[model samples]
Each structure stands twice: as structure tokens, then as C-alpha cells.
Target: MKQKMLAKAVGIALVMAPLASQAAVENIQYFGYAKWGNIYTDNDDHNNGKGERNDVIRASEGYGNYRLGNELNWWEAGLKADVWQDGDAYFDTTLYLGSGESWGDVSIIQMWSAGHGLFASQPNAKVWAGERFYRRHEVHMIDIKYWDTSSTGIGIEDWDLGFGSGHIAWMAPNSSADGRSLHNIDARISDIAISDTADLTFGLNYIFTQNSSYEESDITTSGAMLSALYRQAWDYGSNTFAFQYGTNALAGGLMSAEGGSNRKYSTGVEHDGYSWRVFNSGDLNVNEDFQVMYSIAYQDKNLDNNDGEKWFSVGARPQYSWTDYMATALEVGYETVEAQNGAGTNDMYKVTVAQMFQAGKGVWARPSLRIFATYSEKNDEWNRGGDTYGTAMRNASGKDSVDEVTFGFNVETWW
Candidate 1:
């Protein structure tokens, strides 16, 4: 009896020891967010030539298209796990899942590792490889990822420079063709303070490709972009100004889009062109109960042998808190676009009134439920024979103008 008991105890100890050791080497975490709601519109079928059930309330900002429950619009969720860690070195991965016509699948969006003091004497200097989000910056309201350099490759971040910290990275597109590939070099200098309340950042991105699908010649195609940003912080809010310029293919933002049809210009077409943009966003606190958020942007695209396009947009949102958990808000936006070749020019405007419920009265409060009513209008050019909106409107109601009213509830939170 004693010998049998001893054997069993030894086996259990051996199993438990390995389990404990494994636990010590790995740490895991999970995070995600979901936003869903129902919308009712007066022109669901564009019976008035307004448009085909325009569910989007306005074009102010955010991933609003993700909230539409149609095949193209659906909810999103993601999971992240910090699978391993040791001192300053660790491994992590993220998976993104969504349901929609645009995204109805699971994708491993992030998988990478990093460490400090591994390559140099800088305390926080780090090096990493694999696939990652790279350096993506955006304006939340406009839904514009102005500066995105994410790809599969390697990089060094937090390298100390005399004036500020710097980062350098290389990224490449995945391809199966023999001896054919597109690669980019992205570099930036960040956190260069000019004053107690202000700072600046600068970036350069360049791309070179061999045997690209967009090229007919046997030579390489190349492009480059430059960007600068200035930021100022005050007691109540913050302000940011950003500017960018590049050749048609030089702009990294356009290249990051997956499909050829998703690109700014048509696929398999070689064109010499230039693009530029200026953008500003800010927030202001009027007092203990009132606050305002605003943004404006102007962008231009020109090709050597094609008609150009230009866009201008502005928007503002103001909120008045009735109590710690209740608030009222008014949002207004306007946008105009023109084609250089006289294809057409269109204008749009929107307004929304909302009642919000949340944990606090602050402007940044989250986990909020909002009930809203939106009103929007578009010019005849956008209603008759324009793009998708115009085609849908003409097909549905054959109208030259549209007045739409929508009511819906939305809830948003993150942790």
C-alpha cells in the first residue's frame, strides 16, 4: 500500500511542476469593443429619388459604416493575448473578427515581439519584427487614417536621437510572383517639444517596387511622401495640425488598401500625379457644463494626364451636460468635392441632435448610450447622375435633391 501511494504522488508532482513552470512564462490578456443599433429612415427605398436607404447619418467622423447591419456593414470584435513575457522581452498577438460584406472573417492582424537594451545603450531602445500596426495615426471623427505605414516587416523604435526619439521601419507587401515585390521604408522623429505646451513630429515614407502589377514597363516604380504635425495642449483641451504631400503612389495611406478597386486610382494604370492635404482638429471646454469638438480638412489630388479631385470639409459638435449621467449634444457638418475635368461638383450638409447617457459629465466619458435624430441634404449633382449615392437615388426615386430624417440609438465603450 505504501509503495503504490508513493508512485502516485511522484507522478502528480511531475505533472504539477511542468504546469507551474509554464504558467510562470506566459501572461495573457483579452480586449475588444462592439457597437450595434437600429436605424429608421424616411427614405428607405428612395421613393423620392433621394437615395437607397442612406443609413449613415452624416460624414463627420468615426467608423460609422461599421454600425450598419447590412452585408457591407456589421459589428466588429477582436482578441489579444500576451502569450509570453520575460524581463523587457515579450510576445503578443491579436486577432480581429467581424461580420459584414466588407469584413466577414477572422484575421490575425497583429503578431510581434519587442525588447529594450538589446541592440544599443539607449535605455528604452527596442527592435521588433513580424507583422504589426506599425505607426498609424488618424482623426477619429473623419475616419481618415492619414498616416498609416503598417505592413509585414521589421523596425527599430525608441532609438534616442539628440533632439527627440526616432523610429525606422521596412515593410513589404505579400506576393507569390517570382522576383516581384513592393517595399517601403518609413522613418519618423517624434516628441520634439518646441515649448512647454507644444510639440512636433515629422515623417518620411518611400516605396519602390519591381515588376508591380500597376506597371507595364520592365523598370522599377518608386514614390515618396513627407508629413509634419504640430500639437498643443491646454488646461481644457488639445489642438493638432497636420499636413502631407506625396506623389500618386508615394502616399502610403492609399497603398495600404488591400484591393486594387479600393485604391484612389484605378488598378493596372500608371499615372504621374501629386496629392496634398491639410487638416486640423481641436477641443474646447466652455465651462463646467459645456464643451466643443471641431475639425476641418482640405485635400487635393492631381494626375498628369487625368482630371484632378479636390475636397473640403468641416464639422463641429457641442455638448451641454445636464447632470453627471445625462447630456445633450448638437453636431453639424459640411463637405464639398469638385472634379477638375468637370465630371461634377457636389455639396453635402448634416445636423444631429442627441441625448446621451454615460458615467460622467466629462467630454471624454465613455460607455455611453445615445438617442439621436439626424437631418442631411445633398446637391442635385449628388442626387441625379453622380456616384453610388446619385445612382441609388435616381434608381429609387428619380429626384434631383433629397431630404432625409433618421432616428437611432448607439452605444459605445472600450476597455
Candidate 2:
């Protein structure tokens, strides 16, 4: 499907090339990203083999965009697709055509709800998620949205406010959200805005979601959410300050023994041009089962700044370019996942270093050498033990996480 789609797009571009030279023609663009690397982990317990074929090395993504009449007076459309070696695929596209004038830009298009964009922004970057493995796809279905911007009259340094409303596939219900079905139908309006400041910035997002999570019985759930973020860069002092707060309604499994909201707050800073960065996510639960991470890089330019496809979640990485096609990075991180309310606390530590090299162009080939090691203070951190106390996390497929080395290469390409 992806190859055929790309070929069709190219064929159209070729046919339109001559037309573009004479008359108005839609401009089409194509791009893709690919990465592959060897991965290894050691747990000291050889239940799983070391130097195993790292399955994390195969992934590809591509996107296409077309614009009519060149500028802001016409129509636009975009399509994106991603496929992983592990047999996972994602397809998303949008088409909008409208004109901009005194009434603010208006367009009718199938796109992500304002709420969806806000909620997804919580993740730090493109690559990293809370866990090592990708979560099941949970996103809204197709919906029509009305967007309007150009309304604020703040000044030279004015703020930009955008609003959109539409129906979408809600992720709160279904077996994925626990065995509860709230008969939730997607119908919601979301508003979002970004404030501009010479040295500071802030963003606000609000969503009016309906027919939220459900329960086996007649338990009804519906509500709203508000998220705000602020950041300031102290260029003279070479420092930065940031803070974020968000409140979300809870139902079904997320509902605590006592009804309350599921909220999160975080703050952190960095200096010396991002040689260091720190961030932490905290939960509203009294137990405060949160995750904290701090990372420091040895390179001058943060690897993240140079990364074409930012892949880590905890934060950006700094890479050393050995050559145009090769680079290496050393990363070490410590994470704290507080034991459950009744369970004692357990801490886990991990350290990884990898050297990656790339070859080819379209589907550039990549290979890397990596060493990953993880250990828990209480052995039960990742459920090393069986169903004992619900603490162990087992990977019978791979060896332990204490000390292991992986060596492999992944070849991938995109249109």
C-alpha cells in the first residue's frame, strides 16, 4: 500500500510538472525517516540469551503534502504512513480547502481534535514513551473540524488563539481501558492557544469531552480538562525555567477509591546550551507513583538538536558525529517507579551506550552496537519473580537486564 501510494503520488507530480510550468499547479513534497541499531540487555540470569537479534532495529515512516495555487488562497492535503518490521502500521491523512480574509482563516477538514493534539503533547519527543515498547494505538477516529485563529488583538507581541470542534474516536472505553464500556461516543469541542513573549511562553488547552469512560454497571463519566504550560529562557544567564500543569477527569479504572481528578505537574531547567536537562512526571494519587529522570551529555551540541527524528522521551540526546554517516552517544538514566500503595518501594537503574552508522539514501541502511544493563534494588522491580505480589516484569524472550551486549544492523527505506 505504501509503495503504491508513493508511486502514484510521484506519477501525479510528474504529470503536473509540465502543467506547473504554464499554469497554477499543486506543489507536492515527499520525505521519510529510517533508523536501525543493535540492542543488548543483561539481567545476570541467562534465562534469555544475550546478543540476541535486537528486534528494535526495523522502523520506517513517510509523509506527503500537496498545496494548490502556491500560497494561502487555495487548498491543501496531506497523508502520512508508518510501518514497523514488527508488523505494525499507521495511516493518517487530512484534506482542507478554504480562503483566508478578515474573518480569520476557515477550512473544513478531517483532522485531529484540538484535544487530541493537547493530550498527545505531554510526551516529550517523537521517540520516547513511558515504557520501552509502543502502546496500542489509541486515537480518535475521523471527524470534521472547524478551525479559526487570527482573532486576538494583543499587540506586536500578541498571542495566537486557535479553536476547533469535532467528533472523534475516544480512547477511554474498550478492553484497552480495562474491561469497562461506557458506550462512549466521540463528540467534543477543544480550544487551544499559544501566548508569545520575548523571553517567556505559555500554552493553554481545554476540552469538553462527552460520554467518557464507562463501567460494567450504570456508572456515567463525562468531563473537561485544562492544561497549561510556561517556559522562560534566561539567555544572558544561560539558564531556563519551565513548568506545566494539567487536570483530567477520571472514571472506570482510573477513578480512585475516592472520586477525584487525575492530574500531573512538572518543572525543570537546563544550562550551558542543553548539555544537561531534567524533568519529572508526578501523579495526583496520594501515593505519588511518579517517574523522575535527569540526563547529562558530553557533547557540545545536544544530540537532540541535531536529530532529524527525535527518538527519546525522557529528553533529548546528544550525539557525536564520527563522520557524516556515523555517530555515537552515551546515555545513562535512573528511574524511580514507587512500589504500589501496599508494596514496598523498589528502584531500577539503567545505563546504555550505542554507536550507530548509516548507509544508502532512500532506505538508508543502519547498524549499531549497543550495551544496555538494568538492575533493581529489590529484584522484584521488573517482576523478576513470578506473580508474587504483582511486582516482577518478566521477558522470557530475552535474557536478564543486569549486563548484556547487542550487535546487529537494520536496513530500512521510505518514499
Q: Record all residue pairs in model 1 with backbone atoms less than 3 Å apart, i.e. clashing.
A: 49-397, 61-141, 71-101
Residue-wise lDDT of candidate 2 within 1-415, one digit each (tens)? 6676567557556643443353322233343322223333343233356534322110011000000000012223332222212212222222222323212333332222111112232221122111110111110000000011111111111112234222223232322222333222222222322323223333332222233333333222232222122232232212223222222221111111110011100001010011111222211111112112222111111211121111111222234555556555443333232222222223223334445554421111233322232222212222324321122333344322232343333333233
The models' CA-based lDDT, in order, is: 0.61, 0.24
The residue-by-residue lDDT of candidate 1 on 12-88, one tens digit each, is 45633443455543444455554555556677554355443434533211111112111113454454444456565
**Number of backbone-clashing residue pairs for each candidate, in the order shown:** 3, 18
The lDDT, on a scale of 0 to 1, for candidate 2 is: 0.24
Best of the candidates, TM-score? 1
Residue 68 accuracy (lDDT) in model 2? 7
